[model samples]
Target: MVQRLPLDAFFQRETTHPHKRYMVQPQVGGQIEELSWAQVGNQARRAAAWLRAQELEPGSRIAIISKNCAHWIIADLAIWMAGHVSVPLYPNLTAESVRQILEHSESVLAFIGKLDDWPAMSGGVPEGVPTVGLPLRPAGRFDSLWSDLQAFEPISDNPQPAADQLATIIYTSGTTGMPKGVMHTFANFGYTGSQAVELFDVGADDRVLSYLPLCHVAERMFVQMVSIYAGQSIFFAESLDTFVHDIRRARPTVFFGVPRIWGKFQMGVFSKMPPKKLDRLLKIPFLGRVMARKVLAGLGLDAVRYAMSGGAPVPDALVDWYQRLGLEILEVYGMTENCGYSHVGRPGSRKSGWIGQSNPGVDVRISEQGEVQVRSGSVTQGYYKQPQLTAETITEDGFLCTGDKGEQDGDGYLRLTGRIKEIFKTSKGKYVAPAPIENRLAAHSEIEQVCVVGDGLPQPIALCVLSEAGRKELRESLQGSLVELLERINDSLDKHERLRALIVIDDVWAVENGFLTPTLKIKRAVIEGVYGPRFHEWMEYGTLVHWHDEI
Candidate 1:
């Protein structure tokens, strides 16, 4: 099979379906702007012509700093059309951090688009690098604006880059130290996109929301690349305030979210109908079936044929809850190194808690060190300017040593144990993997986020943040619920792995707070740093549940 670049697939789709709507962007006051395949191609062509006029060195790095907007995709396509590599920065990144990436990548140009926190990130672009302001960019000075570029005609010569040519440099969310730029070729995106579309059986009829940070590999491969490959339509969420409206307006045929989102969706259902009342209704014969449809429709997920949960391990209870509601969410597992093409819980052959079978053309084997190593359709070309770290990640034989530890059952389904570096030793010299334990705690529905830590302590303890549902409950009731959850989880764990207490805190964990990565995965080290000093103080309370405020 010929490995096609993203633009190749997109160009073909544009030619075949010129009138098909490709992007639906939400605007102010419940308005929306829809762009067709030909319309998008025309705009990208105009932008590409402007880029070519600059006469930069071939394969020059062109950066895009924006949220998920139609212009973001257009800018990326224009970069590809101009025969340059693309660099995408998370919209939530600090200005200094942005400067670090733009300078390190040596970005020659940047397209500034819709941003919620533009003031915070505007200072990151170095003075020398030319900036092009898109239609939605918060007021800023730029070398050129999207409106000005509109005067240029579409470039006549269509450019198709080679499959092996460098296509993008996606930086890590930096849960640890400085971010590392992950270099990937056009071939990587093409192959991963093709594999995912085939696995999900996605067609032109399918639609998807592009809410997750497009800079992340999972969203890049699944939303942008998959859409181009499958000729699927894309929708952009305006903001947190309009997320529900956006989802309902799109009514996407496919949906993806992290574990936290799935739990929130469950809670969203509960906000309208109490859990007990809904359960009672679901138990009824014909009424139960109608109720399930109503519940899913209300959440704007009634049309979702393929629902996926990833970026973290999901609890069996959470998955089962959705399953009971007739929404079977498949668990997908991958990382930045592989273009997010590792494993997906295939529809018919899924088992509880498993990451599912290895994707087609992907090889998965457990190393002697117990790390889950994978060689797939789209592994990275190594870290840009960080060869030493790249050498440490990819094995001499070829498999990417995915820092995660896992065990495969007899049927070939894989279950993650924890991060290789996350297994912390207690003061008693016992090792504990926090992921599995956190999954159990998060299953209670009230416990929104949890990080299990015990380094230098006799027993492992959990630091938790409450969900919207949890915060609404009466203090005594919430504490009692947590105690019950703690006892149940402890009963199933080994002595060293058992959590000593559930520390409930008032603080919310978000991407801006440094508690979570841009993709919503917890930053374990960051959490440990902020709370490590008080681990002993909280542990001294000697209670199964410790409310930080009341104490």
Candidate 2:
């Protein structure tokens, strides 16, 4: 049976653990800061007392908008310690998006963190709502997190919250429309965290370096919860620009990344030493081991005992490449509704194109139409304030409709084919699942990003963006590489499903451009609409070489 504990109970248990290490920050200024479990507990207590002094009601929503910092964790725990629900906003979100979340969540208080410009972003907070700024460097405008804690007396009494009470309200990226808050109970998070630690064998001795947005469910559940549950040290990367350097400095035992970041890491490896040279080097006996170790070390992944990829589909070729380097990039499948972990590729049993078997205590099955459904202890009760969506997403039978089309192998491993909503019909009247084909094409080292579109066209065509190193390595002209890649990709598909043409996009799609979610999953519909008119030109011309190549 699963044991349910409040979020604070983990912190309390860790405070007594011999191996407890809390709030490790890798600084860009070539320094490292480490905090002990006792210290973390004290800080949280002080913050909780301050929050109580504010006269906020229990279960009131408090918002946090910032990158992944040590203070972000502190603020999160403080909110829970004060008997409130924590609402996290993506740090890089636009002002409009921020306003939408703040209004929708009905946040009574907000803690803003280090941003490019405070004056501009502050406008997003609703009028009459109390906002506190969290500055990395000492700023005179707002109360410093440390100062606020120091001013308050430690609250010795533990905050009483039921296991089934709401603990967090994490808003989804809203790729389809307005983001909805996914409410998770204390039991939901506690069970998910403990299960993950047990499944992965994470322990007090492990160390995790978290660089992904903590606002996302994947990082919050895996990185933060695992650390708190296992009594392990939690390290924060200084910034995205210095993530590689921070990783090398921290030498964490566990690492997590989105598909895009994993792809970039693989591209960096191939760029440093071309495949031909790497293959030749690996052929040597003793030197091969030394060179491979050096290569992995240089990539800041040498100490990684386990690496996971989630939030999007990872190309199989990338997984194979990492496997060759003595690293297994385990693919995970889950969503905010499931508390972030449902299926995980087991260590030493990974298969290409599969997200692995269902996790312990999670029941998974496929419907007649291939939609993946799951019933798990960690599944959320429902979406916050969205009863209609909740009714549509979760069935009366208690199984959550994952909205993803997938197939299960005889061994019970799940391989996702595509999102049910993303499947489109071709002019030939055949429904095409674009994700499988896109994943196959993206597996090629030359392709960095790809989107398949054919809603009303004769056939589907792929819009591809090549990696910088891939462009340089291919040696051929842009048009030549596109044709070669198209031929290579077509070899793996049926005649009707094969890509009809290739359109090379010079510019990379990113979150800032509204092409990707915060978790780095491509917003396919947005991309299709942005490039829809150009499809005709590309299909007629058969090639586009320029940076702004349309079609």
Candidate 3:
């Protein structure tokens, strides 16, 4: 029989490898701090002891608001060791959104770690609740500092939680509705994290860059749980401005990015090398290989043996472009409900637009309504305090209904068509799926991000944010290149799916702008809510590509 060890079991076992460095944190001004496994374990123990002294109940809820940092992981482990459920809030959330999550979760205490916007985030925490500040950057005035806790006597024995015990209450950053807290057990994380390490062949020698939000399940698994499971050394990115410099110093062997980051990388490349010249240079064999190596090295991805992208569907053309530069960007398909252990595109997967085969021990099937349904040990127990929502999300047959519409190929690779709720019917009574069309349109280097919206209109329209290349083209050619690109896209799409016009917007979508979620997914409903009323005016303009103000 398989033993169900507690999640903190990894920390206990670290005594066997006490001297091994587990985390490398880069500070400002190029300073570096390395912590051994034993040091991390001791900090975690002291943290747990500190929590225990507070007299909170074993299952009390604790919130963590911070960027990706070594102390973030320490706090998470400490929460579990204290037998408390952790609730992670995104550092980029507005004060109101943060208040809503904290109030809803009934969090007893919060740990404030590294933050970019503390004044806004501090306003969200309830006035009476106690707070602890992490080592590097604190969100607000803390009752105690994480460093001060190290002086306390470490807990002699850690709380040995059962496998099925609640580990975390992860709130989904919904685009439209209020965010819901999804509950997952320690067993759920252990099963999925182990499977991922095995599938990706993560070892103690592997190095990883922790720059993504640890609050998100994808980064939580890839950076925190996987690092603990495999005893890998984790590197923390200091800040956005120093991300490239930090990565260069770490030289991580495994890396993961959202589609938006990959898109930005492509734009950065184009800014240095014009597309036409780069295309010409790539045609020459030996020179092309050398150029690719130099590019990857400059981006600090030269040592990356495994790279994956999730949170949004990366355009097929973007994946192809990276592969040409000798970096294969594998696609990941999963959600917060399943601990993010779903279908993953393996290395060298040639099939375009597919998210690859099902992960080991995961069962996936397409329902009659075209929704992707999955059943796995890693699936969450349910949404916290929302049984009706949980029942609606998970079927009676034990499958979690992934809201995404998808189809499985003969080779077992899963190809997502569009979101079921995102499919809209036009005034002509025809249904259109925007993802495929958007995917094709995103192939154009000028287009940074595109959203297709037309709920009750004659047809759908494209709301596009342009890259620097696109901005230059617009200034020089009056949207001439963009118009041609849209014409080509229309030729390939069905009549209903064809865009009425390409409406160019000047503002870039960002978390602070309320255009993107913390995970960097485009907020479709939010976008539609802002632009839906102008569809008729845009259609009547009778231009193939129009500016946003034209309405």
RMSD of each: 1.1, 2.2, 1.6
Report the lDDT tens digits of candidate 1 across residue range 1-551.
76677888999998999999999998866688999999999999999988988999999999999988998989999999999999999988999999999999999999998888888898888988989999888786789999888779889777979888999999999688889999999999999988888888999999999898888888888889999999899999999988998899889899999988898888888888888899899999999999999888988999999999889998888888888788989999988889988988988677877789888899889988899999975999899999999999998878899999999888789999999998999998888898999988888877888999998899999999988977898987777778888999999999988888889988889888889988888898888888888888888886789887766
Maximum-lDDT candidate: 1
**lDDT (tens digit, per residue) of candidate 3 on 118-232:** 9877888898778889987754568888877787799878567888899999999788777989999988888887788889999999999999889999998888888877778
The better-scoring model by TM-score among 1 and 2 is 1
lDDT computed for candidate 3? 0.86
* Regions more than 4 Å wrong, model 3: 1-9, 474-478, 549-551
Compute the lDDT of residue 96 as modeled in candidate 2.
Answer: 79
1 or 2, greater by lDDT:
1
The lDDT per prediction is 0.89, 0.81, 0.86
Ranking by lDDT: 1, 3, 2
For each of the candidates, give the backbone clash count.
Answer: 0, 1, 0
TM-score on alpha carbons, each prediction: 0.98, 0.95, 0.97
